[model samples]
Target: MSVVKPLPNYLVQRYRGWKATTYDNNKAWYRHLSNEGQHPRAMIISCCDSRVHVTAIFGADSGEFFIHRNIANLVPPYEPDGGRHGTSAAVEYAVTALKVAHIVVVGHSSCGGVKGCHDMCSGHAPALEEPTSFVGRWMDVLRPGYERVKDIEDEAERVRALEYEAVKTSIDNLMTFPFVKESVESDLLTLHGLWNNIAEGALEQLDPKTGSFVPV
Candidate 1:
C-alpha cells in the first residue's frame, strides 16, 4: 500500500467545488488548453512566498505564463556539471524547448530567503551558515547580492536594496546560460527584472541603461 494519505476533507471539498464551478463556467477553454498544450509567451521566475500572487498581479490566465517558484526567486550561475539543478533545468526547458519570448525574474519585499541571507551574511543567523542547512546552501546564490548591500548604514534600506539586487542577480545569472544568452543576442528573448512591494502593492522594473530599479 502507498504511504500517502488522501488530502484533508475540507481542502479536497474546496477543490471539488472550484473544479465544478470552473468547468461549468469555461469548459471549452479548459478543453482547448488540454488539447493544445501551453504556449506561454513569458517565463516568470518568482519567490515561493504565498503572498506574492503573481497571476493576480499580472491578470494572467491559466495558459498565459510558465511560472517557476523557488526560495527568494534566485537563479544560480550556469553550471553544466552533472548535478541536480532544478532551477537551471527549468530555465533550459523554457528557453530551448518552449522558446519563450521573455523571461522575468521577480523579487519581492519582505522575502524570507533574502532576509535570511542578510542575517546569515551579517553573522546574526549562525544556524543558516551550517553546512547541513539546505536554506544556507540554497541561499549561497544570494550571498553576492547580500555583499552588495552589506555596508549600508540603515538596516531597512539595506534589506530593501538587497531585495532589488536579488532580482538583478538572478537576471545576471540567467544570462550565464548559453541558450538564454544566444536568444537575447539574436533578439528572440528579452530578460526582465521586477521587484514587488508586498505591503504597498507597488512594482518596480529594472532600468537596464542606468542599472537601477524604477517604479513601474
Candidate 2:
C-alpha cells in the first residue's frame, strides 16, 4: 500500500467551496493564467507563520508574486557545494529563470524560529543545540544575527531585534548568490528588507542609507 492519506473532510469541503465560489467566479482569469506562464514582478520570501498572509497582505491576485515561505524566512549564504538547498534553489529560479525584479525578505514579530534561536543561544533550548536538530542547523544562518543582539538585557526587546536582524541577514545572504549580485550591480534587481508588526498590522521597511528600519 502507498500509505497516502486523503485530506480531512473539513479541508476537502473548504476546497470544494473555494473552487465553486472563487474559482467559478474567476474562470476566465484562471483560464488565462493557465494559458500564459506566470511572470511575477516581485518574489517575496516570508516566514511560514500562518498569520502572515502574503496575498491578503498585498491584496494581490493569482500570480502577482512568487512567494516562498520558510521558518523565520532565513536565507543561507550561497554555497555551491552540490548540496541540497531548497531556499537557495527557489531564489535562483526566481531571479534567473523567472526574472523577478524585486526580491523582498519579510520577517515579522513573534517569530517562533527567532525565539528558538534566542533560546538556543541563551542556553534555554538544549535540544536545538544538538547536531541532529534540523531546526538548529537551519537557524545557524541567523546565529550571527543572534550574536549581534545577544547582549540586550531585555528579553522582549532582544527577540524583536533578532527578528529585524533575521530580515537583514537574509537580505545580505541573497546578495551572495552570483545571479543576485550581478543583477543588483547592473541595476536589474533590487533587494528589500521588511519587518511586520503582527499585533498592530504595521510594516517597517529597511533603509539601507541609514542602516535602520522605518515605518512604511
Candidate 1 lDDT over 1-216, as tens digits, reads: 598998999999999998889777988998999999889999999999999999999999889999999999999999999999999999999999999999999999999999999999999999999999999999999899888889999999999999998998999999899999999999999999999999999999999999999999
Residue 140 lDDT (model 1)? 94
User: Any runs in candidate 1 off by more than 4 Å, and if so which?
Assistant: 1-3
lDDT of each: 0.94, 0.95
* Candidate 1 residue-wise lDDT at 49: 98
RMSD of each: 1.1, 1.0
lDDT of model 2 at position 73: 97
lDDT of 1 at 22: 73
